[model samples]
Target: MGVALRDIIADCKETLDLDALKGVAAIDAHNALYQFLSIIRQPDGTPLMNAEGQVTSHLTGILFRTANFVEKGIKPVYIFDGTPPTFKQETLDQRREVRTRAGNAWKEALAVGDIAEAYKQASASARVDAYVIETAQELLGLLGIPWVQAPSEGEAQAAHMAGKGSVQFAVSQDYDSLLFGSPVLVRNLTVSGRRRVRGRTITVSPERIVLANLLDYLGVSREELIEIALLTGTDYHPGVRGVGAKTALKLVRNGEFESTVAEKLPDFDPASIREFFLAPPVTDDYNLSWSAPDTDGVVAMLSGRFDFSPERVEGALEKLSVKAKQQTLDQWF
Candidate 1:
């Protein structure tokens, strides 16, 4: 569970374009790859796979998607997750259980010819396995995309990068980055597609979330915001029973947080969680640079090793190289 601040927090959104970004975006790698795995599935619920039965949906997303951004002058710095904090183990277990259930549901739906339900469950069951991640990293490397291995959560690391002025924004779909104190968060950076929401398809655009504006609108300190998130449940901990965003906001506003937490969450130590968010483990040992894709390396990895269509790969790379050269010429002139 990410922070349920969506309902209560006011967002400072702007329609994003490639020209508006001032610096590189620190992308949460797993978040993006998982999204790719979740969406690039066939109608029959099977993922895009190569001849060797390796999933290539993540690769397809990375290649074409990053190429699109690069052509339009938006630079991305992909950040990968490291060892998770122990507190998140339970949440990870819960997610695994959910994926298992979704897998079974997908099979059942496929058996019954419920194609829509099968697709939905298949998307829900999508996982970023070791091979998928390793391949993604390798592809990013060959493409000359900068990627960092974070000390912990990728979002946290991205947030840290933004805070340190290393990047302009942290890119993710979750609100936890705000708690990590990222000044900016960009959501829906990957696509402009229709989503099935409550049985209807809805179009979505990229939205920005500015931390300072949100805090000022709510008239709460960053710590108070964290308190509200704790009350509203997060990936690291289950919130108190019967508490939600509204009630949590009220508690924070009324300065009754300690009392209410003591009464309803006797075993919970909010401070520790607060500390975890405030100073999540991250690193500054990485370089931030964008370069032309290593064409030979990219072709060897995707076509020779993964069996992706060499023509398609070359076409996308050709466009990327052309645009990159144009941008370089424009910069110099």
Candidate 2:
């Protein structure tokens, strides 16, 4: 999970139509995969699986969602996380525990025929395992979508690419991309559409956040914004108890971040976290070339191997073909 800075940074977000987002975007692959695993499921929250009991929800998501991106003139380059920072081990362990509990809760809810509760619990139980990652990369190749293996955090690598102008922006639902100094961050790109929330159907649209505008609106430097995130907790460190985003912002603005950390979290060093965000581990050794989708390969994998409907797969490929023909490879970059 990313830092909870949405509450304070809401004003800096700009709602955008799909037509306006025509450019190269570095997508956080794991984040998008998690969204797929969570959202693309049966009524009872059972994920789509093939004959061998392998999960196909992510494949469906990659095929259709990436097609939609291409149809909308967006070139997406996926970035996968390699190794996480050592400081993030606790967070990883905590996430595993949460998923385990949620998985048990999902089974219990399904046993009791509580579809809604099962769905909720199943979403929380979504996991991105090695099999999921490997298959996702395979399908992406068939779709002619490039993917990079980041040396560390995927979001940080995406931010690094965006900062270097290798891509127009970083696409992720998490606000941590901003903390990582991505000049621009696009949210809700993967799951944007009509969504149900609390029994009410709502439309979710893509929103863009520019780092400079956010800093200007908050009247604090990027460093201060990161400090705000630290006070409200991050994946690396549990923040001070009872400090929310607004309170953290105030504390940072009033120049009390160091003093407050000293008083509340005397043993923790904020500098380490700060340094990680400021200069996270990243690599420049990656290719970002878009090419024609391997139609037969895609069909063979999705339909022949997996149990996806051949007709639906063909339709999705048609979308990719129509858009790919309209824009050349040079136009994408």
Candidate 3:
């Protein structure tokens, strides 16, 4: 919800209270680590270190954070990426090209004495591959949490499982899950809202928005919803030049949805649109199992090889314990 990471993290502690993170099976963004590192290389003053020599701060940051969540008693099941959707490859390609161009622009900014642009580009580059699947796998291994190597976006696989009655819910910052038909999605997961309410600091529990409710608001079926997102432009696909979210929603609501979109698409083919919704971009060999998080294995992999922070790992498990007990008590009462 918030922009800056620092502000977001601060809000999480102030509002939702990290202490309350419990029993929730967190689906970690496996692709974010490599993403951040690819964007930000060490500055000129800092000579480049070999892969093995560099402290690998990116991995450490993720490991430390995930471990902390574990300590809070939330059972994190770190899902790793497999292959991406065929339809998404084009989008991925476009994003990578943009990053490459930005790198060039950053150099120019530095030459032209625009430190602000240079810094901004540096920050953007740092965001690339910050959550690489392999990194998450290594980190989760150390913390005793379970890890799932999905065949696509970790969240998509997680959402699919949740919607299909496999998991309780899917947790992620991305709202795209709604299009993927995930019934439940909780936002501000690692962030919180700040409400200064007088003498006592009252932290609100994290809020959630289910897709079903969103559907009710939009007055569209899940299939129609996906169609709606496609028209508006999603991460996976580029939408029409002029069409936007609200406009797309209006068209959907108006009538003869496909024909309406075709009218807008100077060259829109009903067949193409139909195929997109009939079988959206997804993996083939995706599998979902209700295997519990492997606490010991996760801990061993992270701690032994990745040198992950043990304290954070303990913190997530602690949260889980308290939540489990509370659930038990509530059931009895």
RMSD values for the candidates in order, in angstroms, are: 2.2, 1.2, 7.6
Whole-model lDDT values for every prediction: 0.86, 0.92, 0.53
1-333, model 3: which lDDT tens digit per residue? 111112112322223455665554536364445433542344321212333554354555455455455445555555565676565677777767777776777788888877666755654444335334455555555444565666666666667666666555566655565555667765555433433343245555554656666667668777776566667666655655666666666777775567765666646544554454444444434333222235666556545555556676555545544444554444311
When 2 and 3 are scored with lDDT, the better candidate is 2
Question: Which candidate do you rate higher for TM-score, 2 or 3?
Answer: 2
Give model 2's TM-score versus the native structure.
Answer: 0.97
* Candidates by TM-score, descending order: 2, 1, 3
Error of 2 at 257 (Å): 0.8
Give a tens-digit lDDT track for model 1, residues 264-333: 8898888878899989998989988777789999999889978889999998898678766776644411
Q: Which is the leading candidate under TM-score?
A: 2
Q: Judge candidate 3 against the unseen true structure and give its global Cα lDDT, from 0 to 1.
A: 0.53
What does candidate 2's lDDT look like per residue over 117-170, in tens digits?
A: 999999999999999999999999999999999999999999999999999999
Candidate 1 achieves a global lDDT of 0.86
* TM-score list, all predictions: 0.94, 0.97, 0.67
Candidate 3: list runs displaced more than 4 Å.
Answer: 1-22, 26-57, 110-115, 126-131, 191-207, 269-333
